[model samples]
Target chain A: MNMSISEIEHEIIEEFGVFENWVDKYDYLIDLGKSIPKINPIYKTDENTISGCQSQVWLHAKCENSVIVFTADSDAIMTKGIVALLIRVLSNQKPEKILDAKLDFIAKIGLEEQLSQTRATGLSSMIKQMKIYAFAFKEKL
Target chain B: MSNKNNIQSLFPILKSSVNNNKLVYLDNAATTQKPNSVIAEINKFYLKENSNIHRGVHHLSQVATKKYENSRLVTQNFINARHSHEIIFTKGTTDSINLLASSFGQLLKKGDEIIISEMEHHSNMVPWQMCCERSGAKLKIIPCNKIGELDLDMFNQLISNKTKIVSVTHISNSLGTINPIRKIIEISHQKNVQVIIDGAQAAAHVKLDMQKLDADFYCFSAHKLYGPTGVGVLYGKENLLNLLPPYQGGGEMIKDVSLLKTTYADLPHKFEAGTPNIAGVIAFKKSLDFITETGLGNIKTHEDKLLDYATEKLNSIKGLKIIGTSSDKSAIISFIIQDIHHYDLGLLLDKMGVAIRTGHHCTQPIMKKFKISGTSRISFAYYNTIEEIDHLILAINKAIKMLS
Candidate 1:
C-alpha cells in the first residue's frame, strides 16, 4: 500500500524531529541527496530547466495511469537534497492529489527559509512547477 | 578593547548574531555596513531637515539645499576633483554608467569602436552593448590572461582611429585584480580617445584623485564606501561633461522652460534629473568624513594583511584552488574546492553564521574564461579581523567534511 501525501509529510516531520542541531539535520539532508536516484541525462534539457535559481535545476514530469511522476536534478547538492524531499511526497500521486498537496512539511522541518522569495534556492519555484505539471496532466484526464 | 575592536563596535550590525552564532560578515565587496555616524546623519536629516532642495524660499528648504550642495563639495574633495560642479550625484554606479552610455553614446556613429575588458561587471558591460546596439558602433574586448590581468598588447592593437572611448573597471569585482588605470588612460589619450574608469570596487579601497589619474570620467557608488544606498558619484572632466547631452530632464535639471524651446541647466544640474536621494546624499558626507578620519593608507594596510593571511590559510586546505592570483589583487579571495559545489558551501557556511558571496560575483565572462559555474568569494573591509578569517576557515573545513 502507498502512503498518502500527509502521511509521508508526517513521516518526514518525525524523522526531522530527532535532530537537535542544524548540523545533524543538514548532514542527514546531504546523505538523502546522495541517496536520491539520479535523473536520466536524456531528460535534462533546456525546456525542463527551471529559471530564477542561482543554481540550475532540471525537472521533468509525466503522467502514467492517472499518476504523475517527477524526475529532477540540481548541480547544487543542498538544493538537490530539498528536491529529493519534495519528489518523495509529490511524485507517483494522482494529478488532482498532487495539485491539492499542502507541502506544509517544509516549514515543519525548519527548511521554510529555502522557500522564501529572497532565497535564490528556488524551492518555491520547484513546488510551483510541480503543481503546474499536475494541473496540465489533470486537464488531459 | 583593542583599536580594531573599537572600530568594529561602531558598526552595530557587527554585534548581531545569525543562526545563534556571531555574524562573520565577509561580503564587504557587495556592500559595507554603515558606521553609527553615517546612520545617525540619515536619521537627523529625516527628523529635522525634511524639505525638497533648490528653488525654495523657505528656511528649511535653504538649509536642506545647503547641506545637499555641501555633500557634493565633500565628494569633490574626497576624489580630489578640480571643481565641485564636476561631481554629479547619481542613483549608483550602475545608474552613472547608464547615464554616460546614453549621453556619450550619442556621439558614436557607424563603424566607431568602444573598448572594454573581459572582467567588467554586468553594469559596466551591458550599458555599452545597449549603446552599440542603438548606435551603429562596434564593441571591442581587451582579453584577460590566465592570471586575470588584462592583455595590454591586445588593448594597444585594438585601439585605432575608429575607437571612440575605452571603458574598463578600475578593479575586477570577481577577480579583485586592480587594473593599472593610469597606464590605460595614457594609452587611450595617445590616440586622442577618451577613457571612462568604472571605479565601483576601487573607491573604498584606493585613494582617488581625478586630476592625478586624468581619466575622462569615473563612476562609483556610496553604499560600498559605508554610505546609504541609492547614492552614487559620477566625476567627469568639466570640458567633457559640458560636451555630453543631459541624461534626463526634470525640475532641477532645467533653467528655462518655453512652449517650443527649453534651455537646460548648467553642468551638474543638467545631469541630475528629478528630486534625487536628498537624505542619502546629505548623509553620505558623514561616511566621507569617517574614511578621511581613518586614513586610506591605514585601511589599505589592514585589509592587505587580512587578504594575505586568508590566502595562506585557505591554500592549506586540500582540493581548494584560489582564482585570480594576480600579485596586484585586492582584499577579495575567490576560491573553489574540488568536488564541493560553491552553492552547497555557501548554504552550509550561512547556517554557521559565516556570510560569504557565492556565484559569478556579477562577472560571468570571467567565469566562462575560468570554465566554472561560480566560486565562493570572501571580501574584507578594515573592520574585519584575522580572527574572523580563522572562523571562516573552520567553517569551510566543517562544511567540506559534511559534504564529503
Candidate 2:
C-alpha cells in the first residue's frame, strides 16, 4: 500500500468522523490497536522505554527500503490505540518524510485536548520519541 | 439551613458553568468550594487590616494582632482545644506534619518506633517516614483490609512501650474511610504514647472535639475546609508542644536574643515564626462561620444521604467496581470500570463539565493494595446537589459506553 502521510491521515480523519460519538470512535480505535503487529521481544528493552508517559509505551524501528517502519505497544489499550494512529501516519514512510510531516490529524481529531493532562503529556512524549527515532534513522540513511 | 440548595447558593462558584454545562464539581474531597462570605472577608482583611501580628505596636499592627490572635481562639474553640495558646498556625497540613516530625525527631532515640496507617495521605506518611530515617526510629504501618479499613487488631499490637508517637488520619482521603480515631487515641494513651490526628479530610465531614478525641496533636489545612490556602492549624496538648522545642528560628518565636544566648517565646508563638498568612487566617474565621451557621449535623445528614444515593446510582452501571466499601465511609466513591482506562474516563467527564479526581490520588500504596493503577473518584460536599449528581450519572454513562 503506497500512500503519502496526508492520505493516511485523511483516511483516519474520515474514519473518526464516521463515528458521531466518542464511544464508536474508541471502538474503531480499539480495533485499530488490536491490528498492530507485536514488536520482537528482544527489541523491547529499557533502552526503548519512553519516559514521562503515565503508561508504559515501547516503540521499535528498523530501516527497510529506505523507509522507517515502527512497531510499538502500550500497557494501556487506549494508549496503544493512540500510538497506532501515529504509526499509521508516520510508519512505512521515508525517515526525512516522517521527520518533515506535520501531524495535523491529531489536532483535527481533537485527540490532544480531549485527553486528560497526564495522557496528553504522554501523547506528546510519544510523538517526541517517534521523531527522535525518525531523525536517528534518517542520519543512517 | 435545612435546604441543601440554599446552602449551595452561598458559594458563588456554583452560579457559574463549565464547558457550557453547569459545573457538577464532585472533587470536594480534594478541596471544598469557598463561600462568598469567606472570599469577601479575605478582601476585607487586605483592604482594612494589613499589618503583621505580635511584633507591631502601631494601631494597624495592634488591630491585626487582635484579629490574628482571635483566629487562634476561634480555631481553639472550633477544635474544642483546652487553651488558645495550644493552637499554632503553620503553612498547611503537610507543613504541620513536617513541623512535628522534625521536632519530634529530636525527641526520639535509636530504638523508638512510630505507627502510621497504609491509608494515610502522603502529607501524613512521608513526613513520618523522613523522621524515622533521621532519628533512627522504626516506622510501623497498620495494615489495611480488603474494604480499605485499617486492621484494628494489628493497630493494638503495634502500640508498645517503645512507641513514642502514633499518627493516623481521622479519615482516609482516597478511600473515604472514617477511622475510629477516638479509639486509636485511647489505646495510644493507655500505652503512654502521644497521638497525632491528620484531620485534613475529616475537618469538613467530621465535627471534631480535640478535648474529647484527646489526641495529643491535631492538624488540618484551611484550604480543604473552604478557607484560603497557605494557612493551617496545629492543635497540641500544651505540655507536649512546650517540650518539643521551637520548629523554626525567627522573629515571632523568640522572647529575647543576646550576643550568645536566646530565650524562646511562649506556647503558640514559639511554633509560629516570622510573617504569617494574615488574610488567609482571618478569612478562615468566616469559613468557620459558614460551617457553624449551617450546623455540622445538617451538613452530615445531607452528605450521608448524598453518598447513599450516589453509591446506588454508580453501582447500577455494569462493570463499575467501587474500591472502598467501608460502612463508616464519608461522601467519596472511588471506582474503576472493568476495562475502561481511568484517564480516558476522567478526560471525557471533564469535557462534559463533570469534574472528578483520577489517578493514584497521592495514595499510591492504597492503589497498590487494590492492584489497580488508579480509579475515578467523585467526592461530594454539602453544596453538591442531586441535580448535579444526575449530570455526573449522565456523564459516567456516556464515558462507559465511549471507552468500552
Q: Pick the candidate with the highest lDDT.
A: 1
Q: After superposition, how far is residue B308 of candidate 1 from its true place, in Å?
A: 0.5
Computed on C-alphas against the true complex, the DockQ of each candidate is 0.73, 0.32
How far is B200's C-alpha from truth in model 1 (Å)?
0.7
Candidate 2 per-residue lDDT over residues B100-133, each given as its tens digit: 9999999998999999999988888999999999
Q: Compute each candidate's TM-score over C-alphas.
A: 0.98, 0.91
Task: Tell me the spans in candidate 1 whose CA falls farther than 4 Å from its real position.
Answer: A117-119
Error of 1 at B253 (Å): 0.6
Return the TM-score for candidate 1, rounded to 2 decimals. 0.98
Can you list the residue pairs that collide in candidate 2?
Answer: A23-B402
- State the lDDT of candidate 2 residue by residue for A1-141, as single tens digits: 679999999988887777776656666776776677887888889888764334567888888999888888875566778888899898899988888888988778867653345443366666777788889988887
Residue A22, candidate 2: Cα error in Å is 6.7
